[model samples]
Target: MQERLNIVPFVSVDHMMKLVLATGVERFLIELAAYIEEDFRRWECFDKTPRIASHSAEGVIELMPTSDGEAYGFKYVNGHPKNTRFGRQTVTAFGVLADVGNGYPILLTEMTILTALRTAAMSAVAAKYLAPKGARTMAMIGNGAQSEFQAIAFKAILGVDKLRLYDIDPSATARCQKNLAGMGFEITACSSSQEAVEGAEIVTTVTADKQYATILTDNMVGPGIHINAVGGDCPGKTELHRDILLRSDIFVEYPPQTRIEGEIQQLDPDHPVTELWKVITGQVPGRSGGRQITLFDSVGFAIEDFSALRYVRDRLKETGLYEELDLLADPDEPRDLFGMILRAAKPTPVAATVGAL
Candidate 1:
């Protein structure tokens, strides 16, 4: 049997929780934002695609995969709004980082909370390019698991102070308010989406339902507002009225993926939209005037997950916070895959030598 050496380290959810607490969520958001922008700047260096999804009556599950010519990664995440009723998180996610050179996994960990952080970070990155200068006071249309992260992201990255919150579920709004209370944000619980959106410079939507629900109509939106559409990340799930998309200058992470999942799903396939990476890379323009409306259709692309995975891996290395896992057998002969496991249990040497006819 061929023997090989591999390194795979894993960090549990508890370690991740400790990492966030030690580094601070704001710092994590800032670092993630920087990494995402850095990766987006080199758009052609990565292999990108839309995520694969499996739908069911309760909710939907997804697999996001991407590669940067050298390294590959993927995440498994589920969105079930009803799960919270049973004391389970509405979303449960796990991801793996792998070496594309040898097609072997290097690390795997839970990403339920990590996904929320990355989604918020991505939204903030788009807002940094598209939102007006000195933009603060955001209106959050849906207050669920994502609301607190969105609030903190905007607050830290964009200097937003005031947040007007609205959600169909009163408990969800209350939960968001309670989580964000100690963070020094000026939170206002609005009775409706329209009330929440009134006079706000940035409007963020992160509802969890798995259907087409109009959280923001065109008439409710005013001029010069930057919309961060977060929850409408799957096919047939949308949050904005079609008219709002028709009136705004739409921006997206990846056009090919966003076309099938973002708020622009309501627009014609031929409708014009700007890729946010182009703006970050100076290949395109962002907001040109204070009177212009900007929309960021964030569908949580695989490249963002790629960036997040790399960031987490690096952090674990820096802090020495991971455990080594024996996921794959390293057989010295790369071609002798079958003998590696068999010999591990029984220390018998293989009979056939490689290339011995």
Candidate 2:
């Protein structure tokens, strides 16, 4: 076995970008989805909980932790919807994976981009089971950094070929259109959320606001549409109206977490919502009929982050897109940590000669 204090693999932002580019974003999403699905199938083995969050007036900071008996993982993430005004990303994250045997981190990686990738992947996974049959078009209501990734993941996973884009900021929609040019998508930039969701099979609401703003009113939602609500992730944040939750068959990653953070927070605490893992594992039914509305109230869970971290860790060996970080102390003896620090304090021969002079 390798020494625990030798070095930990660190994947910085630049290295992560390189790895994603080399692997191809769509392919990476597909592969990452596979890992997530695999974990969900064996869901009973992992220790799960709602993410720990600290809310501020401007944003929220969250720590998501999980363990699967053998390995442990956690992610530190923050969300600030107003950050764009200062030319900063709305969400940024980093994650660590450690050995359960020794409690030492084995990998540390930037999760800002990885979070987007995994969120898209997780949405696609849910859509596969909950979306209408033969779904091809998706109305993307938010065209920020996560827009292209969501479009591509749906395309790669659910064969979605058409995209209708809209954003409160027209510039964001334009940027999304420019980024998705010639990506085999029949794209349209709509002027309003109503226009975007018109005649769409899947309506994805990902607007970033720290309030209970209704991006999609109940009147706007129709039958046979899968609502991928991604942005309403904090206590007071929500996208769809309360009536929409009543009419749809809601599916969530974890109810305890989603109840506090997801769109379903508007509903009763004990409202019936399907656990998504059960659907993936065939323990329950999804999309019972063409007219049934399915809502995936995604709040971003720890297990999804764990799956994404594991996927990146596995890929690092092949791509060599990581740096070795001296993140731990390597003492001569495990119990002599203080002695190791004291030994390093001894002067070198050059220092001793200069002192004598």
Q: Count clashing residue pairs in model 1.
A: 6
**lDDT of model 1, residue 203:** 95
lDDT, candidate 1, 1-357, per-residue tens: 112245577778887888788889999999998888999998899887778889898888999899988889999988787887899998899899898998888778778778888989999999999998998889998887788999998988999999999999888889999989889899999999989998899999989888899999879999998999998988889999999999899998888888998888888898999988899989889998988999998888888888888899889767877777656655657687787666666665453232121
Output the worst ten-in-a-row residue range by lDDT, candidate 2: 348-357
Name every residue pair that clashes in candidate 2. Answer: none
Model 2 clash tally, residue pairs: 0
| Tens digits of lDDT, candidate 2, 173-217 | 999999999999999999999999999999999988788998999
TM-score of each: 0.92, 0.95
**Candidate 2, which segments miss by more than 4 Å at Cα?**
1-4, 347-357
